[model samples]
Target: MIFTIARKEFRSLFAAPSTWWMLALMQFLFAWFFFVRIDDYLQVQAQLTQLANAPGSTIAVASPLYSALALMLMLLIPLFTMRLIAEERRNRTWVLLLTAPVSVTHIVLGKFLGLMLLLVLIVAGSAIMLVTLLLGTHADLGLMLANILGVLLLSASYAALGLYFSALSKQPVIAAIGALGMSFGLWLLELSASDNRSFLRAISPNAHFQNLNMGLVNSADLIYFMLFTATLLWLTIRQLNDERRSS
Candidate 1:
């Protein structure tokens, strides 16, 4: 049943022309950045070779791409997630979902999974470009996989937070703005808190993501992502249940 809802949401997103336009825009931006990075790497290749411990192609090229991709997810996921519940509520379709046989948990999970599929598509688009690195240079497979994992987890956290905001507001624009504000706020928190041991930096998703982006996958970072995602998902479920009771 969760998958059924997820599939429906996935198809619905693809049905909209705006979705295609957004995807195209993202890919275009990624391609531009990717080529620019490659060009820069080539320009500095000679200098890097002279260094005792020079970074590889993966570090020089793919790391920055993934970092940019993470920033892109922060901006784009909210746009899609805003419509998940807020639009349905605005259209008077949320009542249908509320009265449906499926539990609130299922609905929330389904919506989140649907968004995950879109996130995966976006990440895969970037991955396709990263794969081309193998042709010209030796790519760091381990680092690449770590970055991929970091991206997926980071996007999932974004989606979960956005989902909660979508449930909180009937206006899709408000939901989008709320999600964006919170995401940016957390990023600011990471920046302002300079101490690595500070609680604020410890709670910021960007900090944890940076750890994985550097290919240092610690258990602490993994746990942070899990707790962050699970807490928001739980809150979303509770919000929907409260709405169901109120209605």
Candidate 2:
């Protein structure tokens, strides 16, 4: 049943013209940043070569590209997730979904999985661009894998957070704005900390992602993302259950 809902949600996304436009925009932005990174690397290649512990093309180019991609997706995800549940509520379909035979958990998980499938497409586009680096220079496969993992977790966090807001509001625009505000607020929290060891910095997704972007895959960061996503999903489920009981 979850798979059925997931497939339906995934297909519905493609049925909309906005999905196509978003995909195109994502690629265009990625390509522009990629070329800029290459140009910057080329200009500094000579100076880097003179240093004994110079960073390679992978660190110099690929790392920053993934970091930029992460930030870009951080902004774009709220737009994508805005309609997940909010649209249903606005269209008066929320009652039908709640009355369906499927459990609230399945509905929420299905929607999350659907969003994740779209995220895979976005990540794959960037991965292809990253792989091209291997043709001209030696790339760090380990670092690349770490970066991929980091971005996936980060993107999942964004989806989960947006999903909760989507469930909270009937209007898609309001959901988008609320999600964006919270996402940006968390980012600001990370930036406002006076020290790296501050509790505020520790709680922000950006700090953990930075560790992974640098290829340091700590257990704590992995745990943070999992807990963060699970908490949001759980809240979404509870919200739907309450709505069901009331209706």
Candidate 3:
């Protein structure tokens, strides 16, 4: 039942022309950033060749690329997530979904899963540029894989939160702004805080992703992302339930 709903939602995303245009814009941004970063990395590599060998040289070489990719993904996710529920509500289609035989939980999970599937496509597309970097270069494949996984998990978390916000608003434009504002604020909070307040860092997906960006697979970070995504998804279901009952 959930898969049926998911399929419907996933197909709806592609039925619209705007989704394709947004995806194309995102791909162009990623490709442009990749080219600039690769050029910068090559220049740095040439300089490093003349310098003494540093400890953990391989990790050092890969960190910049991972960092750049992570930044690019952070900016792209909100655009995809903004339309998850808000647009449906705006178009009067959410009521139809609410009146369906499926439970609110099923609806929320279905939409979430649909967005996640689309995210996989976006991430896989961006990965082609990263793979291109491996040609004639000494890149750590394991580290790169870990970074990609981290980005996916991080993007999922953001998508979940954005979807929740989308469900909360009937206005898609408001949902888009709200999602971006919330994400940007969370990023700012994590960046402004000190390590002594690391407990607060657990609340920010970007913070957990920072560990992943460093090629460190901490169990705590993985758990944080899972819990964050699950919690927000639950909230979305609850919101749908409340809205349905009120209607």
Badly placed stretches (over 4 Å) of model 3 are 52-62
Q: What does the lDDT come to for candidate 2? A: 0.93
RMSD of every candidate to native, in Å, equals: 0.7, 0.8, 2.2
TM-score of candidate 2 on Cα atoms, chains taken together: 0.98
**lDDT score at residue 144, model 3, on the 0-100 scale:** 74
Candidate 2 structure quality by residue, lDDT tens digits, 1-247:
8898889889999899998998898899999999999999999999998999999998988899999889898989998889899999999988889998989999999999999999988998899999999999999999999999999999999999999999999999999999999999898888899998999999999889989999999999999999999999999999989988988
lDDT score of residue 146 within candidate 3: 79
Q: Higher TM-score: candidate 1 or 3?
A: 1
Q: What local lDDT score does residue 121 receive in model 3, on the 0 to 100 scale? A: 83
Model 1 lowest lDDT segment of ten: 9-18
Rank candidates, lDDT, best first: 1, 2, 3
lDDT per residue (tens digit) for residues 46-91 in model 3: 6777878732333664556556666666666676677778888878
Clashing pairs in 2: none
List candidate 1 stretches off by more than 4 Å.
Answer: none
- Please report how far candidate 2 places residue 111 from its true position, in Å: 0.2
As for model 1, its CA RMSD to the true structure in angstroms is: 0.7
TM-score of each: 0.99, 0.98, 0.91
